[model samples]
Every structure is written in C-alpha cells, then in structure tokens.
Target: MLIVKNIKNTIKYFIIILAISLSLSIQTLKAQEVAIKDIYFHTDISFEFSDTFGADRYNHFHEGTDIMGEQMAPLYAAVDGVVSYMVNPEGSWGYAITIKGSDDYTYHYLHINNDTPGTDDGNGGIKNAYAEGIERGVSVKRGQLIGYMGDSGNAESVGHHLHFEIRKPNNEPINPYNSLLAALNSEEYNPEIAKELSGTINDDKNIVSSSESLCESNTLIKMADYSTVYYCGADSKRYIFPNEKIFYSWYDDFSDVVILGVKEMEAIPLGGNVTYKPGSRMIKMQTSSKVYVVERGGTLRWVQSTSVAENMYGEKWNTYIDDLPDSLFFDYNIGEEIVST
Candidate 1:
C-alpha cells in the first residue's frame, strides 16, 4: 500500500510539471505571436503599394510588394528578427537586408537607400542604407526603424520605393501585401510635405494667362499647390491619371509634368479618367467581385471563369488586378465576357 501511494504521488507530481511546462510554452508563443502580429510598416506619411506577388517579371516572378514612397522615407522591421544577411548592394537587391524572424519566418527589405541625402546620386553607401547600429547578426525589435527607401540598382527607373518581402524558413518567398497594408501607419499625410519631397510643386511657375500659353495636348500638368496629375488631351480637356499605376503605364518619369497655377489648371474642362494601358493589367470594381481585363479604348471584358483568367494572364493572374472605385464605373464600357478564348 505504501509503495503504491508513493508511486501515485510521483505520477501526480509529473503531471503537474507537464501542465506547467505546457502553460509556459503557450505563454511564450502568445508573446511572440502578438509581437509579430502588430508589426508596423513605418512611414511618416501616406504611401502606396499594390499586390504584385507572383506576377511575371523579366525572368523570375516578382517576389515582393513594392511600397512606393518618397526617397529617404524611413522603413521598419516587420518582426522581431535577427539580421541574417545585410548589405547585398549589387544590381538587383540593392542595399538589401534579410532577417531571420521569430516563428521561423524571414523578412526582406530590398532596394534600400543608396542615394545621398536630398539627391538621387545612388551612392549613399552603408551609412545611409541602414539605421544606426543595424548590421548583419544584429538583433532588431519589431517596428524598429531599419533602413530608408530608395530606387537603387535595377529599381533606378521605377522611382524611389522599398521592395519588401516575407519568406518561409525554407527561403520560399510569400506575398507581404496583405500584412503590410494592415500594418501600414497611414496617418499624417501632409500634401505640403509630400510636394516638398517630390521637389516638383514649383518647377514650372510659367503660369498660363491666356489660351495660347495654356498647356499643349499630350502634356501632363498639375496644379502648383497640388500633387494631382492630369493628362492634357488634344480635345482641349484634361483627363485624370487616376492613380500611380495608370500614370506609370503612360510615362516613365514625371520630368515633363508641367505645373500650372490653380486658376489655369481649373480652367481646363475635366475629361474622364485615363484607363490602364490595354493588356498591361487587370482591374476590378470596389463594389463588385467580378474581375475584368482592360481592352483597347477602356473596354472592360469580364472574365467568365478562373481558367480563362489564367489562360489570359497566367498562373498568377490575380496579382495583376487593381481595385477601382465604383464611382469610376462610367469611365469604362462593359464588353463581351471573356470565354475560354
């Protein structure tokens, strides 16, 4: 009886220890998970990004979400991670940093700043690329400022932005779009500061006082005090660029964007919004789930099935789609449904 009692006591003690161990494990996991769940995509003002993961690039698929922002904008760590690799500083992954985040995941920040302060010289070097004390093997906290955005290396022609990616422990890339959008600090968007960062608000003080001095057709114009760009059409009306994607599809850089005074810019009658370059992208309305492919002259042909969408845009076709506001429905005409063909 005595032996049996002792054995039972041992068993009870073991059970208690096991329960305590499990509780501790759960608490640890919850702490790490919470830390990761609240990661902040650091930015002082509003920025823009699109989900282009798995989209076809020059050769390989686009593995990252490009967060478009002003040059020198601060970027933050996506999670509590140890800097696994830092300073790739080559052609493609310019001034890149890789972190071995908790939960066996990884985070990548590429196209980091390589430009001198207040200039696109692309030679800011290590001091400018990373935050103070950030280096390989450095332990970084979640939401800590890690680097600055830039358009270095192959991203030189695309404009200043940060190419952010998340990966599994196996190094397979995953889309960071959803997570980033959820965590982005979208407050304090000052247009005056944005215009100052753009350095284009006052480039063209040659205000138009008469019709002859008005912007010519095919010219891009914006108000001196605003950042909205419009395409001055041959019809003597100005069409809105709608968004960055539509604007980028039409031109490379904003070098030719003429700045006009408010009165002159308002003088031109507003035409409809410009559509995406035909076949370059797909779009869907915010009010509807149905996706449409843009055809010539702003015709939107609905894709009848997923297979047809894949056949038209490839395996990662969904990544190419952008959501448009319901108010712009009149800007496009609904064409025939895209069947298997």
Candidate 2:
C-alpha cells in the first residue's frame, strides 16, 4: 500500500510539472517576432477589403492584402526562404512571387516587374515577356530585393502596388493587416476579419447597391467635388464618392460608363452588353477613350474593338437577374487604343 501511494504521488507531480512546461512553451511561441521591415505599411491602395472573391461575390471572402506603392518600388523579402510558387501570369496579380519562410509561413508578393529565374510561373500570361531580371535558383535572405513593383496586371487604372498574402498550410488567406501591426510593433498581432456585405434579394427583380445595404446608419453616399459624374451597378445608379479608389474602364466621353465588379452590363442595359460564362479566359482594358477586348485560348491573342466583352470579373458571385450585362463587362466609349506593358 505504501509503494502504491508513492507511485501515485510521483505520477501526480509529473503531470503538474508537464502542465507548467507546456504553458511556458506556448508563451514562448506567442512572444517570438521575426525582424522584418523598417517602414509603416500603409493600407491606402490595393489593401482595401471588398466583397469580391472569385465567383462567390456576396458570400465569398477577401483573399489578400494589397500594398499600395509607387510604380517600380523595391519589394523586400520578409524572411529568408526560397520561391515556392512563382506564377508569372497576367490579370489581377500580373507577376506574383510566393516565398516560404523558415517558420513554415508562406508570404505572397505580386505585381512584380521581374522574377529571379528564367522559369515561368506556369500561368503563361502577357507579362512573361516583360521579364527583365532575376537571381534564379539562389537562396534569398530576409530583406533581399526580390523584385520591383510595377503595374503588370490586368486592371489599367490600378497604380503600381504589391498584393501581399500570408497563408497557412491549409491554403486559406490570413489577413496581412494583422501581421502588419506586429511588423510595425515587435509583438505578434491578431488579424481582424472583414464583415460581409449583406442584402436581401427581392423577388420583384430589384437590385440594390452593396454600399447602401452595408452603409452604417449615419453615413450617406455623396458625390465627388468637381469630378466626373457617372452611373454604376444594376439600377444605373449614379455615384461620386471622393477618396475612394474605385477603378473602372474610362472609355471616350460619349461612351457608357461602367464599373468593374459593380454590376453586370445586362443589369443596367447600357453597361456590359456581352456576357461570358464563368471560368472562361478573357482580357479587357478601359482606356481614356474606349474599351478593348482580348480572348485567351492556348496562347493566341487577338483584338476585338467593337465587341462588347462579356462578364469577365463578375459571374457566379456577382449576379443580378433584373439587369442585362453581367458584372464583368464595362459599359464605356473608346477615344484611343491604349496597350499595357
């Protein structure tokens, strides 16, 4: 009986010690911070969170954090890692680089002017040809200059910016803003998830703006001062909100004005006239005068000037049955042909 009691007491003491050790281990893990940058990461440009996520517009989530910067800004490596995924494809993220960190965290850097190696990111887009330089197959250190910033993607009006993303092993996008706070301060910070923009779909075929539904109680939609007036969304509603970086194709002065990912051309009848089914590959640009169209299929590119491009940005998630053109197409007139480099 004495031996059994002693053994039981030993086991209990061992359990208590293990619990204390585990608690200390967790505190150590939470306290560590990787020394990264010396600048206050601003959220002015592309980092603005919106409801657009692939095809599921309303229910989907924002994928990455956009780092607004001047054209050709230097993009530094956050931590020492090799390029795990390097996709040189065009569109929203023209030339993107994904670096795996030592702590098993993945960091994504997009809108690059060039990649280190001559290897293709396998997307095979237009920006691949613009490849200027890289330090291919070499292990890069933390804060190493990986690439330069450029407007290398699909959207024309978008200034040069870096679309940064941090993901876990499960491939879900973790908000970069939360991490930004820690880099701003040495402690590890928590990220805030954006609230979903919700609204009811009426049976009378009526379409309402997401802002009108998502707008806080005291705020109201107002026009910009001494700026261009325009109409948008399914109901052909005119909007002019200053200080908002809303980008759309600006065709000629006589043409129809349409906003990307706002409302379909078919919804307003005057905006996007043509529509493409979901998952189809198409390239479009809004110039200062008119809209240009391009279609991608196994890499043969051609121009269609008069053809009103169908739903490119908006398909499954951005749908309005009462309107004509889908969210992808932009309703605008062309003044001159503008090509992106």
Candidate 3:
C-alpha cells in the first residue's frame, strides 16, 4: 500500500510541472505576437496614466495619452531610434520631441519644460536634449534621457505632466493606452479608465482593415523646400496624416555618419553630460551644426560640442576626427530664439 501511494504522488508532481511549463510557453508566445513590449513609460515614475489615448479634449479628439509627474522629471526614450522632430510651437504641444523608432513608429514626447532656447532649424522650436550634439539624426537608445516633463505650450496652467503619443509609420496616431498597459505589466491595471477615455479596448482591429489593399496604398509629398517628407496611408476613404513634420532632410546625412560605440561610462543626471574614468577612449561625432564626443556609458551622452572639444579632445579635437571615405557634410541652423517661460 505504501509503494502504491508513492507512485501516485510522483505522477501528480509531474503533471503539475508540465502544466506550469505549458502556461509559461503560452504567455511567451502571446507577448511575442503583440510587439507592445518595445514601448515604455516616458517618465521615471509609476505607470499611472492621467489621460488615456483617444480621449476627448475640449475642441478635438485627444490623440495621445497623458501621465502626471513632477516638473523637470527626466523623460526617456520609448524605443531605440533617431531624433526625428523637435518643435516648440507657441500655445500648443509646447516643447515636443519626436523619435522615429527602429520599428518605424514615431513616438512623441510633448509638453516638456522650455529650459533650452529654440533654434532656427526647428523654426524657433524648443530644445530636445540639454547637450548641443543631441539633435535631428542623433541616434538614441531605449530608456535614454531625452527631455523633461513640464507644462509647456498650452499646458502652462493645466499642470506638470507628459503628453505621449505613438504613431504608425505613416504618421497616423494609434491608441497607445494598450501599449502603456503592456509596458507596466502590472496586475492593478485599470481597464475601466482606458475604456472611458478611449471608448474601446484593443480597438486596432476595428480601426484598420485587414485588407491588403488598404495597407499597401500610400502617397508621398515633398514639402518645406523638400526638407520634409510626408507619407499618407489610405484606410478606405479616410487618409491618415502625420500630426507633425515626419521625415526631414538631415536624415540623408546619416549615410556619412559612422556609429561610435562606447562601453562602461556614467551619465550625469539632469544635464546631458557624461563622465569617463582614466584610460577611457573617446570618438568625435560631427553633425552639420555641432560636434559631440561619444562616450560608452550606461547611456550614450552627446556632450556639448565646445565642452567636449575642450575637455575630452583637447588640442587634437580638430585633427582626431573620424575618417570615413566619401563622407558628405552639411550645415544646418536651429530655430529662432526661445521665449522665456
């Protein structure tokens, strides 16, 4: 009788282990299918969303989601990509930074504080990174610090928070609340709030038709003296347009640029400065407007052009430039001076 009981116990344990393994495998497959894990929280706070994607604003439909946080809180990259557009329009999105993700999605971080001045290239838009070398065409990694949270633009009186949006490759706004929820990976996620604001959960299927004809139809237009490229995607009779400038001329300049990889460095908080210990090697990255010393740290930091030259490069700054054959260089200007907050 005792031998029979031991055999039954062994069978039960085997069944339990098999069930657990199967459950984990199923979850892993689901996560892979969604592709939502690439998105992340814009700020360094809890994933509490104050406003949901597709929520109704006063005049127009709220295309993005809002997260409330303290002013000057660091904003991070939602995915690895290049800085696409940095604009600080008056009485609107305030200081905005848009990054084109490797997956072709454009992530927008809006309503940042107006700390740095605007430039001519940005059409008098506010600064995105505190450092000089951090601009259009600059490569950034996931979770890298890009800006700060603030009530810039129309949110001056509203409160300190971040207005975040995720756009399709064609520049059409997709509901990001689901993506945010997936990023949090929390059990306490409030589906009710998302439903109240967006009117539907997991509504992408309803918004875009599965027909291949609708997905493949696209039209391109050149604007801003051919410096900007606009892509319009057709969803049956309706066309999806970019909320802001999508592709810029400077992107072509990346062909001549060589990526400098650095490892084991520490980044200075608040300021976009990075520090390296003795025996560290540095590389000079020159854009059309400014130069940056690329350092290998926890995160890449583009130290100010002059500061990097003086401190890291010293006298060899000019002579020690990276040698890439047939490299093309161009000069670009920033926007007008920024107005004081």
Alpha-carbon RMSD of each model: 18.5, 21.9, 22.5
- Model 2 regions lying over 4 Å from their true place: 1-60, 88-93, 114-137, 186-341
Clashes of each: 0, 26, 13
lDDT of each: 0.68, 0.39, 0.47
Lowest lDDT 10-residue stretch of candidate 3: 264-273
Write the number of the candidate with greater TM-score, choosing between 1 and 2. 1
Cα-based lDDT at residue 118, candidate 3: 25
Q: Which ten residues in a row have the lowest lDDT in candidate 2?
A: 189-198
Model 2 residue 82 CA deviation (Å) reads 0.9
Better of 1 and 3 by TM-score: 1
lDDT string, candidate 2, 96-129, tens digits: 7777776667787766653222322333332222
**Among all candidates shown, the one with the greatest lDDT:** 1
TM-score of every prediction relative to native: 0.43, 0.33, 0.41
Error of 3 at 25 (Å): 38
- Of the two candidates 2 and 3, the one with more favorable lDDT, higher being better, is 3
Query: Across residues 1-341, which tens digit of lDDT does each residue of candidate 1 receive?
Result: 99999999999999999889766754443232212234456544357888777665784567777878887677767777899988755555688888787777888888888887678887777767776578888887655567778887788899988888777677766667667766653222221222222211111111111223356766888988788988776445777877898777557899999888888887788766787655667789998999987644466778878887777667998897899888777878876576655
lDDT of 2 at 305: 29
